[model samples]
Target: MIERLQLLVAERERVLGHFLESEQREIALACHSIARAFSRGGTLVAYGVDSAETDAAHVAVEFMHPVIVGKRALPALAPPNDVRGVLRSGDIAVSIAHGAEPAPVRAFREQARHRGALTIALTGGDRVDSDHAFAVPSEDPQVVQEVQETLYHVFWELVHVFFEHPGLLDDACITCGDVAIQARVVAVRNGNAVIEKDGLREEVAVELVAPVDVGDMLLCHAGVALERVE
Candidate 1:
């Protein structure tokens, strides 16, 4: 029994460490996008099939009624049985699927995308063409679901952070208007740039811009530093 417990802890730690190391930037970007959508009066619509339905419902509830005290409740809904006409432009759609990506989930994502909603998919490594596809790298179904649960919880939390910092989403920074938002590069690794903006640190993909160095001021957009602020 002790050996089994050790093995379980070891596997979970391995997977959790890998996810944190590899997917932090992606998760941050997703949170920024979702927060922007909410700021624009959008809603979060979640759905799942079979065993994944519970997760979908749980996501909706968490968003609509935050468990944390003082966290603002945002609008969220989970479609019952069918998702037709439930999504609209400026909404954020989340599809939760275990094992393989089901056909129904794919169709729902497509429909949501066509309606101009940002789509997020949590699947078992199968491509679902979502705006943000978080593939669970683990082969074990249990581990995959556990990782996905943690992922969504992180999403929910960080999105609130973005809400707290609305300046990060302003168009002035993207258009180089009078308000020039800049962040100092604290570190760079594997093409991901970590920057400190407004006293908050975030990791953004910097491949679209020129060579960056530590302490350089960068012009950021949608969680990515598009260029160096000269």
Candidate 2:
């Protein structure tokens, strides 16, 4: 019994270490994106099929009723029906699955993406069509679920870091005249551009200029770039 327990503990630790090391950057970026979504008054919609339903519910509750005191509650829910029914643009869509995501979950995630929601997939190391995907290193269903649970809890904790800094998120109400602001594109990802102006960085929609690249200067207004500055 002691040997069996020790082996299980060791495997869990090994898998967790690998998961964290491989997914640290992805995890950070996902948290920031979730924070930005909340800043834009977007809700988080968590969903899954079968046993994964438990994880979806856990994520919703954690965001809607934070465990840490003084942290503001964020809008989140695990819809009992199709996630697409509640998904909206700028919202965050999260799906939990083990190895081989069910067809329905994949379909729902795709639908959410089509509707302009930020998609997050917690799966067992499968390539998913999402803005951010974090996979546990182990294929063991129990291990995968446990690590994903930890990931979401970490997400809940780290997302607050961005909220503490107001400048990191876009301010929708800050607009004056028809004039636009010129900013240098620092980074671009998933239809959004991270632009820097006088050392202040902000994300703006770059869909109008689909081919935006780093170091490109753009004319931005109302949280979206109108065109490139030549």
TM-score for each predicted model, relative to the true structure: 0.74, 0.77
Model 1 CA deviation exceeding 4 Å by range = 172-230
Top lDDT model = 2
Indicate the TM-score of model 2.
0.77
Q: Write the per-residue lDDT of candidate 2 for residues 24-98, one digit (tens) a residue.
A: 977887898899899998999998888899889999999999788999899998987777888888899998897
Q: Alpha carbon lDDT of residue 90, candidate 2?
A: 86
User: Stretches of candidate 2 above 4 Å error?
Assistant: 171-230
lDDT of each: 0.80, 0.83
